[model samples]
Target: MVELNVLVADLRAESAEIDALVGGLSADDWATPTPAAGWTVAHQVAHLAWTDRQALLAINDEAAFRAELAAITVPPERMDELVDAAAAEGAAQPPAELLAGWRRGRDDLAEILERAPDDTKLPWYGPPMSAASMVTARLMETWAHGYDIADALGVLREPTARLRHVAHIAVRTRDFAYLVRGEQPPAEQFRVELTGPDGEVWTWGPADADQRVTGPALDLCLLATQRINRADTALVTAGPDADAWLDIAQAFAGPPGDGRDAGSRERERRTPA
Candidate 1:
């Protein structure tokens, strides 16, 4: 059984950490653009807050949430464009109001997930997810977007063992990656082994599996979240599906993402633009 309460606690803690980071930023700082093209820091936070509200609706009122999604009228191929436009609208609020809205949504989400029945599935943009998976997905998004804010502010966050949750979801979603690309999922389970922040080995899949991916846990999480391009990281892959999976390993639900380019090269190109 999934320890959903634990996941909820982690989700709450992740949101709190991000809240602390953004809380001290000046209005000017909040206007800084992140690596995500055309999205400012305010846009990042606004997206998180908006998604949180959607998640709450999914949990509490599935029919209403689905109706709302249907009303948006964006085609599958243009979902990202729609999100950017929606985020711009959501980002119109002042920093304080944005932060408050984010905190309110985060707190409400944690509370609802905590009280939810363990076996119940929550509706989402993609397939419905269990309470555990839902909270974990929220935690994953918190960490990923938090990275964008930190990078935009030129602050490097201390990596944490909490990344284990993300890595777990990333490994479990291997097949989803292929399916999202309209490709058939390989009928093989590849081993994944990552060294945690504290030098502990965290692993998934069979010990003797022919296919394996091994890397720093943080790199794996960043790769899964598409924060860092697969080519930029020292992640090792040794199988047919392993490399292909890296090309499309997305932990979150949505259409496929255009991941970042190599780290240093991307920075050089974008910093002066």
Candidate 2:
């Protein structure tokens, strides 16, 4: 089992970094569009701040969290408006104050996680998961949204070799494979090999694994989370699950994303004639 402390340290550093990035931005920059579908920079930060707070509330009050979770499935327009409203509120405060408040929320979350018992049960929007899993989910959320912020600014944010954190979630998205098939999930662990920055490749699962696959961690993360298409990158597969991953690979424990296969057409357009 991974140490919860490692996760806390990473998040503490990233949250502060994220706050500074948002705090330094001008009003125009706040309104600038991010690569994340239909979200502005403010929306991105607001979601993070809101989510961190929600996790805290969920940890202490599962019933209230479950009730609120039900509203997440409401009409798309309503959800959009809700998120937009949160962004507006976040952006309304002074930069330093906003940053201070955001840091406070995340730090408080870290404290809650520190004291969380090993067997603690957390309520998830998708399914019931452990407190540890919730912490991982928070890390996953930070990376994904931070990717969006960096992309819009044309800056490359390098998370230390700890991408193993996000990659683990991506690899575990095996069940999401079944959702694409429109069938029940199969009880099996698929092998995954993902190469990270500096050409370090990480492998999960047994060496003699039947369903072999190898690829860049970026592609794997993007694909599993439906941020990019399998065909859009150099990911290779040599077993039965190859085709399945191509069809669907979602990491977040929820309904499939609308962004899947987004870059496929552009990817094909860039191919040689």
Candidate 3:
């Protein structure tokens, strides 16, 4: 398990970075659509705020969380519709109000996570997760949504060591990815090797594992977030399960995501434009 303090620190930094990104945006900017199809910047921030509130509920009142979960009427096939409705309702507020709401929710979550017991299991939308895993999930969602916001606003966020947290979750969730797809996970663990932002090498799985993935940490994080299509990344996979895992790698807990379309640039290269 990752040190909870380190994970919380990273989550704080990630939250701060996102705050800075949206802190000065105009109403028009907040309304701008991001790379996520049909989701504007406000929608992304609103979703984060809503989830933070949900996390708070789960921590403070598990019975309430269970009740909330049980009230869901949308079937699995319409999950995106459920998300769209939630985002729209949440984003209906003024831009300043939205930002403030998100900030308050984020701070509340950070404070709770800081004091949570290391081994405590918290019920989430998916399976129960440890406090550290909960914080990491928050970090991954923040970073992923932050990426969408940055891209929409034409800002380039420098890759940070924080990506290691996202990468770690991505690797840890490999089995979840398989489970969500209703496929049996490989009984064997495949090696994951990534070059971190500072050029430090991060390795998971056994050193002598026959299956392996090698790539830049940023690419791995993006792939895990589904921000980039697996077909477009520079990652190299050298095993049967490794290749399949890359195609469906999702760190977020949910139904299998609709992965990104291979960008127009990739499509153009394959055709004469």
Pick the lDDT winner: 3
Of 1 and 3, the candidate ranking higher by lDDT? 3
**Segments in model 3 whose C-alpha atoms lie over 4 Å from true places:** 264-273
lDDT of 3 at 163: 94
- From the highest TM-score down, the ranking of the candidates is 3, 1, 2
Q: Which stretches of candidate 1 lie over 4 Å from their true place?
A: 264-273
Off by over 4 Å in 2: 70-98, 186-188, 260-273
lDDT per model, in order?
A: 0.86, 0.70, 0.88
Pairs in clash, predicted candidate 2: none
Write the residue-wise lDDT of candidate 2 on 169-268 in tens digits: 8777676557644767645556788888779989888777777778778777767656665657788886766556656777765455666444642432
The sequence of per-residue lDDT tens digits that candidate 1 reaches over residues 1-273 is 348888888888888878878998899999999999988899999999988998999987889998987887777767888778768987889999999999999899899889888678888777788888888888999999998987887767777778999999899989988887889998888999999999999989999999999988988898888899777788899997898888889898778888887763244233320
Native-structure RMSD, model 1: 3.2
Task: Report, for all candidates in order, the number of backbone clashes.
Answer: 0, 0, 0
Quality of model 3 by C-alpha lDDT: 0.88
lDDT tens per residue, model 3, 23-42: 99899999999988889999
